[model samples]
Target: MSEKSRDINFLKLFGKNLRSIRESKEMSQEEFSSFCDIDTRQLGRIERGESNSTILTVKKIADKLNLPIKELFEI
Candidate 1:
């Protein structure tokens, strides 16, 4: 795969994992975004794999979820 393709694949996987985890916590996207101190729209984009989120944003998410940063990337 091209590098861009690889990155897209990874983003999709990460987004899937993040969505699963968030749902497992029984939090709506709005609630979770508020908890993570992020914009609800941005969180939605991240969950849909449409945004290239920053590491700081990722860290904020993981922190809010009480998970390690690596957990966000788990398949």
Candidate 2:
């Protein structure tokens, strides 16, 4: 596979993990965005496996969702 394809696959995994965690918390993307003080569009990108979210972003998301950072790993 090409490097771009590999990156896409990895992003898809991350997105799936993020979506699962968000759904498990019973939160919408909009709500999560609000809680994290981040842009909804950016959150959508993360959900769609388009953007490479940083550790800081992940931590903010976890904090917003009231979930432990460990929960993200289980994905």
Candidate 3:
């Protein structure tokens, strides 16, 4: 696979994992976005892997979820 394709694949997996954890916690996208101080539409894009998130944004999400940053990368 090309480097770009690999990156996209990883992003999708990460997004999927994030969504799974959020759902397990019974948090809706709107609620989670508000708690994380992120825009709801942006969060949706991130969850769909349609947008790349900065490290700080990732940290914010981890902090809001009360999870380690590494957990977001878990498949």
Task: Using lDDT, give the best candidate's number.
Answer: 3
Q: In model 1, where do residues sit more than 4 Å from their true spots?
A: none
Higher-lDDT candidate of 1 and 2: 1
Off by over 4 Å in 2: 66-70
TM-score of each: 0.94, 0.78, 0.95
The TM-score between candidate 2 and the true structure equals: 0.78
How well is each residue in 1-75 modelled by candidate 1, as lDDT tens digits? Answer: 899999998888888888899899899999988989999999888888889999999999888878899989878
Q: lDDT (CA) for every model shown?
A: 0.89, 0.84, 0.91
- State, as a TM-score between 0 and 1, how close model 3 is to the true structure: 0.95
**Residues 1-75 of candidate 3: C-alpha lDDT, one tens digit per residue:** 999999999889888988898899899999989989999999899889988999999999999878899989979
Q: Worst lDDT window (10 residues) for model 2?
A: 66-75
How should the candidates be ordered by lDDT, best one leading? 3, 1, 2
Whole-model lDDT for model 1 versus the true structure?
Answer: 0.89
